[model samples]
Target: QVFPAHGPGVKAPSLQDGQYVLQGVRALCLRANNTELVSGGSDGSLLCWDVTSGSLGRLVRTVQVWSN
Candidate 1:
């Protein structure tokens, strides 16, 4: 999902170095004025990612949702 910083409608070069891959995520939510991304998925893990480089940045906070 790389896009031009100036023209977001335009596609840009990927930042991936091919040494790593991000996986198992769903329902993306963006915040921090579009600089930060957040999502939770089937792994029952919620994570916030860096939008600029598309890397797993920091472990912001976590929550447990008990399934009945």
Candidate 2:
């Protein structure tokens, strides 16, 4: 979960419906601007999030890195 480092009235990010159930998170990166996030999951999927939005829990983009 992303936590706002220091804000007077920023709300915590909330999850949206129909989101993926990640098996496990292998890697996580917060963008240099601190407005985006990228995560690689064990399911071979990469998810991108908009950290500036309230519904950051729902992925803005998803990509399958590999398939069996």
Candidate 3:
């Protein structure tokens, strides 16, 4: 769900990319100042983006989930 950076009132953009390789997103959040974004992918990966600079930051941390 790629939402507009302007505000929550605005609608998110349609998914133009292909199907999600992973099934679910465990968590998603944005900086209170709206200068950054974060999301956790099902494939045990975490992504952080710097909205103001339009660049991806380094991975702060990660957790591996093993299928039972």
Candidate 4:
């Protein structure tokens, strides 16, 4: 899941057809600056992404903190 850091250009994930299994992850934090997305997940890592590319979940970089 992703959330915008500030005003404007906020969007939600769309449902495709019926009974589709969606991905689950705990996002500890989120920040958006322009088209860039910085997210901290429960997997004990930080990821930078460009949300404008397709699913937009394209990871630009990764920083591992600690894993469970």
Candidate 1 error regions (>4 Å): 1-23, 61-68
How many clashes does the backbone of model 2 have? 0
Against the hidden reference, what TM-scores do the models get?
0.48, 0.46, 0.52, 0.34
Question: How good is model 1 by TM-score?
Answer: 0.48
Candidate 1, 1-68: lDDT as tens digits: 64343342423222233233333444678995798888764334567888887888765544444545
Superior by TM-score: candidate 2 or candidate 4:
2
Error of 2 at 42 (Å): 0.4
User: For every model in order, what is the number of clashing pairs?
Assistant: 0, 0, 0, 0
Better of 1 and 4 by lDDT: 1
Model 3 residue pairs with clashes: none
In model 2, the worst 10-residue window by lDDT is 7-16
| Per-residue alpha-carbon lDDT of candidate 2 for residues 1-68, written as tens digits (9 for 90 to 100) | 54443323233222333354425566889979888788765555467777777344545445656657
| Pairwise lDDT winner, candidates 1 and 2 | 2
Clashing pairs in 1: none
For residues 1-68, what per-residue lDDT tens digits would candidate 4 score against the true structure? Answer: 54454434333332333343332234633454566666554333355666576244644444555547
Superposed model 3: Cα runs more than 4 Å off: 1-26
Ranking by lDDT: 3, 2, 1, 4
* Candidate 4: RMSD to truth: 9.2
Candidate 4 error regions (>4 Å): 1-33, 54-68
lDDT of 3 at 26: 62
Q: What is the full ranking by TM-score, best candidate first? A: 3, 1, 2, 4
